[model samples]
Target chain A: MSDYILHCFAQSGNAYKAALMLELSGADWKPEWVDFFNGATRQEGFREGVNEMGEIPVLVHGDLRLSQSGVILDYLVETLGTFGWETEAERREILRWILFDNHKLTGYTATLRFLRFIAKTGETDVVKWLETRATAAYAILNKHLDGREFVVGNKPTIADLSLCGYLYWPDEIGIDLSPYTNITRWLETLKALPGWQHPYDLMPGHPLPCA
Target chain B: MSDYILHCFAQSGNAYKAALMLELSGADWKPEWVDFFNGATRQEGFREGVNEMGEIPVLVHGDLRLSQSGVILDYLVETLGTFGWETEAERREILRWILFDNHKLTGYTATLRFLRFIAKTGETDVVKWLETRATAAYAILNKHLDGREFVVGNKPTIADLSLCGYLYWPDEIGIDLSPYTNITRWLETLKALPGWQHPYDLMPGHPLPCA
Candidate 1:
């Protein structure tokens, strides 16, 4: 029997985070994919699968249910111990970038992605504000990546995975990625990894690359 | 010799989270208090203390320098093995609650506190929006704390620390804690813990809470 079941929408960045970790860890698990576009997350049955707060990337391990992508990643890393980023110092950097993505990047990019693609709302004040936040966020990333290959020191860690999953949506939203050459190069490197899937691939007929 | 030095503003919630873990772990460490009111964090010296990101609480151990509160907390738990919350199951829950606080509670409560006390901007739209967010966050907490004494399970975990640290600030901002009786009760319980320090105690002139 699989040790755990990942409940998430296939294309979600958060879901992909769990998937990435599971694949990296080589853990025995099955993906119980949920249709987030169709409000599967809001369903009462699915709600029961998670905590009272309805959020994605919920990992159900026997009787224990875990929510939040960062938490799930940490859990898999700790339990499975398959990856090199599990070291003490490296783990701190990994977490720093993960929290950074959640605090700074996700706030704006997700908003812009929704407005431009899902919401179909064009050029409104909110959209502009999101765009500005996205721009600032990208600039910060661009500066951080100036001489570095990966986000942290040298090796590919959970930091890279979390960032790659979130940044994968840029092309879909017609946000130019060329300006961030380091990020672009990093994404290419990330895609080369085994079990890598574009965000839209998990969603049927959602127009690959979002644009 | 101490393994690390934690640099933080005396009474910051973020800083306290790191210190609490260190103290609980019995880790050898020294505290370098930064004066936030005097813009110590913005100085080049502090920026160098935390890489280019320039945020705290920053942890320095030998050649390693780490920033971001969540990252620091994880590092302490992973490395020291002193806190019970470091367990696989509890760790994930801890991360979830920390992220929940960062993404949801901190923004709203911080803004509310700033408006009510620090800035006194009287921006009704911002205050109203913050109040709404705070209410939603509190409702989630109240439900989660229905019968449990702590945020995660029965015992006090890092989740409780992260949530309680932020929640304790609401009263300073004139937020009526009376409505969330459960949260208030839980806060009282947490405040009575050993090494618990009121944020105001770190400030120059504010009256310290009678222990």
Candidate 2:
């Protein structure tokens, strides 16, 4: 039996945030596919049993069940003893980036991708608005990465993992990543990390039945 | 001089999250108003000097300056030594709710309110989409607060402060809070805390010049 059971599906970048971390850190973990597209998360049973928030990437470790990818990543940092900060200031810096990722980066990019690629909503007003917001978030991150190899320090941390979650699918998201030179450079840096894997390759349920 | 300086504006719930924490915890903090309405945060100087992310609620203490409300709240937990968890488990729980607030609740609600009330976009497609997302987030939080007075533990914590940052302006957000009985009750419980103040009352830049 795996030590950490991550409730995830390849379609979910948020879930990828956790799956990538567990795999890269070489944690004893397995993916429990979630049928998010078919409304698995909206079901009452999943809500009550797995997570009250009805979100994915729920990590079940023995008696401990954790939800929220940021929380899961932070927990893994303590348990796996990898990709974590040594100083309090560095820890806070990593956290600052993680919070930005959740609130601004992933928050906009995920919805934009769902509409543009998955749901196929086309360029509706909502999609356009989300694109604008997502692009703005990208600008901030790209500017921040101007001279830095990693998000917080010279080493990779969970902050990089969190921000890069939804960024892997630039084509699916319909965002031109070529212009974001700094972001592209940073993503390549992360890709070179020893155990890094693409979201689709890292988790199950990829190539949705229709695809 | 106040030991803590918070760069904020009256209309920003993100800023209020930090301001309320400082006030409720009886921290020696003062608000340094930012002209967000007049595009202060968009200026190159503000982005470079204040926050590279181009946001507000930057908490300055001595030489350290911090942005992102979640980061600020967590930092306050350590410095103020109040509204913090006693155990690692409890800490993770608080972090879970804070992540939910940032990614789901505030992410949608803030945008919805900005369009509906501040920008007055007038029921546009984007506004409608944001409302749907924001309402869904509200339902989840409302349900979570059903049997609990606070977000994480029995006592109030930064989790509650983080989640309730923007709920006070239901009318402005155009979401009637009457239906969410649990959330309303929880808000009241928080209001009954020793030192509680509305965002407008607590931060500067209220009553815009036009108003």
Candidate 3:
């Protein structure tokens, strides 16, 4: 059996966050495909057995099951000793960016992509609203990346793994990445990392029939 | 001088998360109010000086400045040595909930409150959409709070502090907390904690001139 089993679907950037971490860490891991597109996460059994938050990217090891990409990333840092902070200050700095990613970056971009690309909801007030917020978040990140190689430090950390989670799908997100020059450059740096794979290349359930 | 200075405004629950943690930790901290409504955070000077994220709740200690409530709360765990995990597992659990709070709980609920109470944008499609998302987050939190005194571990951790950040203003958010019995009980439990204070009481910018 693999050392880590990730309950995830391909289209989920959140899942990709954990999945990419596992793959890049070179851990013995496997992806247990989840039918998120078919509302698998909404089922009661799944809720009781898996993530209570009804989200995916759950990492299972032996008898322990952990949910949330941030949690899994933090845990892997100890077990894999890769892409982790060396000091408390670095840890907090990494966490600062990760929290920003979850709250603003992925928070807005994910929903916008779901509405525009996956759900196929045409232009609407909600979609526009999400786009505006996502744009603001992108601007902040772009400014932060002005002279930085990674989100936290000179080297790749969980912060880069977290912020760059959904940004890889620029086309699907329907937002021109060219405008955010800094973000695009920073994302390219992440792409240059070893074992880096696009979300579609990383997990299952890609190219949904309806989508 | 206070050991900690929290750049916060009373109207911001995100800021409240850090301020309340400082108060409950009994840290030598003082609130340094920011005029959020007047676009203080959006100003170039403030963005360059305080938080590049263009948000409030930046905690300053000595020469170090920290943004993001999750980061500040985690830092307090080291400085105050209270409500922190004793094990790696516990630490991940706490972080998991904190991420959930940022991504879902506070992510939707904070915007909902800002639209409904602060911006007074009434009954728009965006408002309705946010309400639905916020309500879903509330239900997930309420269900998670079932039979548990705190989020993550049984003891009050940063998870509880982060999730309960904006919940105290249910009336303002126009959500009936009575239906979420577990969340109400949990909020009361937090209110009972020593040094606990309402955001309005703990920080500045309450009772905006128009309100």
Candidate 4:
């Protein structure tokens, strides 16, 4: 029984990110599932258990509680000394793209996908809205991926892992992917990773992999 | 001159969070203003400069290029030894609140505020939506600030700086703060820091103290 415990929803992309990182780092930890659908996250006990704002993918190392997938990933990378992603300059580039995934790509596309698929209620214009944002996101990714195999540099990093969780979901939401050849090829390379298969196989109703 | 260079918008709260951290670290740096409103950020030259996605608050230290306010804040805190905000156990708690601010507080409030003020486009039951989300965001803050001066523990940390940027904008967006006395009091306390007034005095009409 490892002393580290990860509290997160099993199917959440965010949760999977942390789980993947933990596996990649070979850290001993227990994965405790937090039920998102049941509003278990909103409970007072859970909130206090982790922090004031009860969000998931919270890693507890005995008494210390860490939140935010990015923060947790960085903590693991630093503690484990697994800087295989990039060199000093490239690490910063990785950060920039990871932030981009959070602030722009995942921000809009995830919301639109959630509203359309999960919520099953919203304006009909949401489809168009998602397409526009998804296209724009892919354009950015496509340009960056033009001559590279990974996001920041030659190796798969936490940045690639973070973006892959979202980028792999376009077809499920009826978004097209035929145009981004580089991004598609990169996804193939990422999926070739040993732990990558677990998330794809585990995600419910997993969409067909990128073209 | 110190080796750090921060590229950010002059009046952005997001940018200010990074700036405040740099100043607190007492690191010598220069600010390169990116005119976001005019799409100066979209230029290939500027995009390639710091972030391919072209967002601000991109910190360049030596050869390191970092983005995302939360990550940058953590890097600063870790590198500068300025861990004044919370105790060791509470550091992750502070991070939780910071993530919550990004994921929940700013998440809803930005949409509501944008629909109401900037877009002037979501008039259909917009006020109701704004009120609901604003009340929820404030209630969370109010609960967190109940008896504490700072967000996490007694001392102010990057967490407070991150959340303060969002809460300070209520007046501009017509949010009623009279109900959240604890937040208001905390805001007043935070605003009293030396150079705290710089963000406000420098960027008039900007909502955050450091904006």
lDDT of 2: 0.93
lDDT of 3 by residue, B160-210 (tens): 998999999988998899999999999999999999999999998779998
lDDT by residue (A1-211, candidate 2, tens digit) is: 9999999999899999899899889999999999998999999999999998999989999999999999999999999999999999999999999999999999999999999899998899999999999999999999999999999989999999999999989989999999999999999999998888999999999899975
- Stretches off by above 4 angstroms in model 3 are none
Q: 2 or 4, which is superior by TM-score?
A: 2
Q: What is the number of residue pairs that collide in model 4?
A: 0
By TM-score, is 1 or 3 better? Answer: 3
Instruction: List the pairs of residues colliding in candidate 1.
Output: A172-A209, A172-A210, A172-A211
- Write the residue-wise lDDT of candidate 1 on A15-99 in tens digits: 7777777775677887776667777766777656465666778888878788877777777766776444745567666778888
- Model 3: residue B65 alpha-carbon error in angstroms: 0.8
**Candidate DockQ scores, in order:** 0.46, 0.94, 0.93, 0.31
**Candidate 3 per-residue lDDT over residues A1-211, each given as its tens digit:** 9999999988999989988888888989999999998899999999988978899888999999999888888888888999999888898889889889999999999999999998888999999999999999999999999998888878999889988899999999999999899999988988888899998989988778777
For candidate 1, the TM-score is 0.81
Instruction: Give the range of the ten consecutive residues with the poorest summed lDDT in model 3 chain B.
Output: B82-91
How far is A2's C-alpha from truth in model 1 (Å)?
6.7
Candidate 1 vs 2: which has more DockQ: 2
Please give, for residues B40-87, the per-residue lDDT of candidate 1 as tens digits. 776777655454565567888787777877777766666786444745
lDDT of 3 at B51: 90
TM-score of chain B of each: 0.82, 0.98, 0.98, 0.82
Q: Judged by DockQ cut-offs, is candidate 3 incorrect, acceptable, medium or high?
A: high
TM-score of each: 0.81, 0.99, 0.98, 0.80
